[model samples]
Target: MTFLAISGSARRASTTTALLRALQSAATPAHTITVFDRVGELPIFSPDRELPSPPDSVAELANAIADADGLIVASPEYIRAIPGGLKNAIDWLLSCDALIDTPIVLAHASHRGDDMLGQLRLVLGTVSTRFNEAMFLRVPLMKKTPEEIARLLSKDASQTELLDFLTRFAAYCGSAD
Candidate 1:
């Protein structure tokens, strides 16, 4: 299975991105996880641009989403809400058919982003019928450097948890009913 993991943080060294990257390494031979950390590169969405075609960045992201078997979104809380960039990326996809039936889940890098998580769940559920509200992975990597996070996630216990999460999500994606 191929999964697209999107990092909501645009920081040069986001712990969320590190967590997703670690998941990439922990994936088994039967699965592949690709991290998409360029939400910041997408221009703010507008209804007017949806006519002829969206911008190249928006098209690229939509294409990736269309190609992936599933999506895993990880985001940081910003003022108790979803970060603007991640929300913008979703907005850019609202009219696109890529997300309508895609299997999606959430991975949380911080233990403190429940507020953002709630909002993200609501938004994603609205956009995709296959959004799995039940399957989630939350690791408390907040305030840690990306390097530290990478090392921590490399530990045996963390690897086990990540692999289990990926396996469950992949099964969910492949299930017929």
Candidate 2:
């Protein structure tokens, strides 16, 4: 199975990215996980630009999501809501059909981002029919380095939870076949 993981933060060293990296490492050899940490690079979404030809970055993001068997998103909460960059990326997909039935799992790396998570869930549920509310994972990884986070994920308990989530998502994706 192929999983596409996206990090919503644009910082050089963000907990969101660290969590996604740890997820990438935790995946079994039988699965491939690709992390896309370029939410900052995507152009601001506009319906006008959607008509003729979307930007390369937008097109690339859409194509990547379309090709992946499943998607995982790790986003940091900003002001009790999803960050602008990540929300912008989702907005770009609104005019397209790439996310119609794509299976998605959401992860948040904050101790208190339930509000943002809820908003994300509502938005994703509205946009994608296959958004799995049951596959959500929340780990308070703030202030931890990527290596530390990866080591934590290597622990038996953490690994089990993550693997179980991935396994369930993989099964959900397979059901689409």
Report model 2's TM-score to 2 decimal places.
0.94
lDDT of 1 at 27: 96
Candidates in order have lDDT scores of 0.93, 0.86
Worst 10 residues of 1 by lDDT: 91-100
- Alpha-carbon error at 156 in model 2, in Å? 2.3
Alpha-carbon RMSD, each predicted model: 0.8, 1.5
Cα displacement (Å) at residue 70, model 1: 0.3
What is the C-alpha lDDT profile of model 2 across 1-177, one tens digit per residue? 999999989999998888787778778997788999999998888888897878889889899998899899888889989999999999998777778888887988889888889999999989999888877788888888778877787799998887887787788889963
Candidate 2 residue runs with Cα over 4 Å from true position:
none
Residue 158 CA displacement from its true place in model 2, Å: 1.8
lDDT string for model 1 (1-177, tens) is: 999999999998898998899999999999999999999999988898887998989899999999999999999999999999999999998866778899999999997988999999999999999999999999999999867887889899999999999999999999963
CA displacement after TM-score superposition, residue 62 of candidate 2 (Å): 0.6
